[model samples]
Target: MSEADFIARLRGIATDPAARGLADDVAVWEGLVLTHDMIVEGIHFLPDEAPQDVAWKLVAVNLSDLAAKGAAPLGVLVGYSLGDAAWDKAFADGLDTALRRFGLLLLGGDTVRVPAGAPRSFGLTAIGRAPEGGAPARSGARPGDQIWVTGTIGNAGVGLAMRLGEIEPNETCLAAYRRPQPQLTFGQAVVPHVHAMMDVSDGLLIDAQRMAEASGCRFGLMLEAVPLSAALLAVRPDVVDTRLAAATAGDDYQLLFAADPAKAPMIREIADGLDVPVTVVGHAGVGEGVVLTHKAQRVPLPERLGFMH
Candidate 1:
């Protein structure tokens, strides 16, 4: 089937009340909203990547955004570029697995084909509802708040490196890169106590800068305090600076949040209950820029802390 034909078939199956027939306007809502992203072969994923992994990643990335806002996944609309029948079946199988695992339903979407020799692309639009009270915003953090991260950092980036054969793909490293488990439960647990929150798609340094900019506060990150997975250390034993670099590399789907220091014990308890480690990496200040301190000495911040357009 051609891309347009696929889309027409998908349109016939779509049932999202918020989509309004996919007329192409930005979706707006009071307690919920819609967001979409597109990933292209040779751009988002390597041409030879597995169909299952690609499908999983497409859904997981969108869920990461919803989790950052403390929202629940409602459903998703998918747009796939037409491929051969065998490839399409594999993609669908992968999508189904991810959707079932994440409690997300495939509402409906279009599929089409690009011109020959053009890069193949896939798009997904996710609809999510905010928490009962309200979703956490990137703008709500305040000075005097403690910044915390859920789980270890750098796993996904390390995994990607291994996948590219930059390093050996030991079990640890491979787990980090592929099949990143989004901190959905942890995000929900921290929502009530957190003043601001976001998933660590980009490196912590960059994402922290974003929170600071959005909330009009300064962030002080303690370099020694950033958490690293056992996998990262296993791969690069003597690299003292690996953690710092990981803080700027994209693709870790953990949550970075700010909460009152007084709530630390409770937050830790919550993390323990969820079996996810929570680490206090820094504090938010009244200043304007993000600062990194190593043993009380200020370190030079990276020019680009994370992903940049």
Candidate 2:
């Protein structure tokens, strides 16, 4: 079954308040926020990618979910697939470094050897302490709320293209893809002001559609307002197609949130204080799904919104 279909089927068995109807990524139970993410060779990462970067990606992606819930990471449980001895050793070292960098503990986990020549895969389950007031939910968005996104969009996707030799290499894009930084601190600080929040993993457009659907609202996005970093613009032009491509590229771990229009000044202040750039890309309206506009002209939805399993 498709990812959505599988999740839909599993929802029947996950009928608990903490499950949040399986509409949100993380499960909030008691005072803990929990999330699990997996990265596979040839899919989430290139087969020839460095073991250390792969390890970092595995941990960072899971933490990104916790960050969306405005939680402070506590620890992680790693599931490893045994492969080459040297590679495994490097991955372990990388994992140790990542955990230390994030101030997280290596709780415990399992290890198993995969079949010979099988693709390597790794899984991490991250646990975090939820924010004091309660974690924000993707389904909490309401009509008239302003939509905001942390950091620039499409850098990671562009980075992937660079790795594939599809574009010229740039340090900014390369680092973004190799080591995605989750907005943990910002998420925690902005939780109280946001009506809804989620990390942009699969792609801005797809994730936005998910939030809109879960909240039973419409997202009216302005392509021109979708923030693009100077590094990205230096490589690509400032045009509708470029914006669309960025919007659809996945692997961006930045946070996308909704808040009251009146919270704009406060949001800006929080972002300024944290030294993180945030942009107002859209607004929630009384409708459903997502609508796009570029230079005040309607734009058709792209056939492939983002990566899907």
Candidate 3:
């Protein structure tokens, strides 16, 4: 069975409304937002990847969930799989760097050793406080709400291509893959404005589809409206395929949100204050699924919207 299928099997086992039927990324418990995320060495990161980068990814991904909930991080509890002294030390340095970079604290954690040659795995539990307007939900989107995305869409996808040697490495693209910046302050500022919000850790389209499913609305997205970084466009030709790839690529860790049309100016101001890029990619409508368009022409949805697992 698929990982998603397996997760669905566990839904009824928990009754807390905070769990959101296992639909949202993080559990909202009163004023506290709780999340746990796991990453595997071979699956989530290249085996040769720097320990520091892996550690940073581990922390950043979880914090991104908090960002989606419009929460201020309080601390983290890490579950570590020890490799060697040198590797663990490097991971510690990376973890310290990530914590300091985000102004977070390490509350507590445990470490363990795996069998020889086993793929390294790590998990993190992040605790955060919801914002004044309360934590927005993936299922809160209303019809006619504008779909907004923070930052450029496809830089990390390009970075992944570079990491896999499919494309030559560049500073901007490589940095995107190795280090992702979670939109903490921006998320907090947006909580009061957004009807629904989430972090784009998976490909933009897949995550957006999730929002659509949760919201019970049709999302009409303009292909040309999706933002792309100069770095991504420089390495990839400006074409439909490039845009599709960007939409379907994962690991961007930016925010995807829906707000009323009237909130555009306020949203832009918030983003401007944070020095983050925010764009209106589409709008929600009184229907289901998603509709794609390019230059006012309807296009069939891609066979794959984004990462499945």
Model 1: CA > 4 A from native: 1-28, 238-240
Question: When superposed on Cα atoms, how far off is each prediction in RMSD?
Answer: 7.1, 0.8, 0.9
Task: Report lDDT (Cα) of residue 188, candidate 1.
Answer: 71
- Predicted candidate 2 versus true structure: per-residue lDDT over 137-251, tens digit per residue: 9999999999999999999989999999999989999999999999999999999999999999999999999999999999999999999988899899999989999999989
When 2 and 3 are scored with TM-score, the better candidate is: 2
Candidate 1 local lDDT, 1-309, one digit each (tens):
886677667667765645434322213257775778777888677787788888988888778877777777889999999887887799899999999999987899998877877777999999888777666677678999999998888887788888899988888767656676778777776788889888888789988988888789999999878888777888865343786778887778788899999999999999999999999999999987799988788888978798642
- By lDDT, the best candidate is 2
Q: Per-model C-alpha lDDT, please?
A: 0.81, 0.93, 0.92
Model 1 TM-score?
A: 0.88
Candidate 2's displacement at residue 146, Å, is 0.3
The 10-residue segment of model 2 with minimum total lDDT is 300-309
Error of 3 at 259 (Å): 0.4
TM-score of each: 0.88, 0.99, 0.98
- Can you tell me which runs of candidate 3 are displaced by over 4 Å? none
Expressed as tens digits, the lDDT of each residue in 109-128 for candidate 3 is: 99998999999999999999
Off by over 4 Å in 2: none
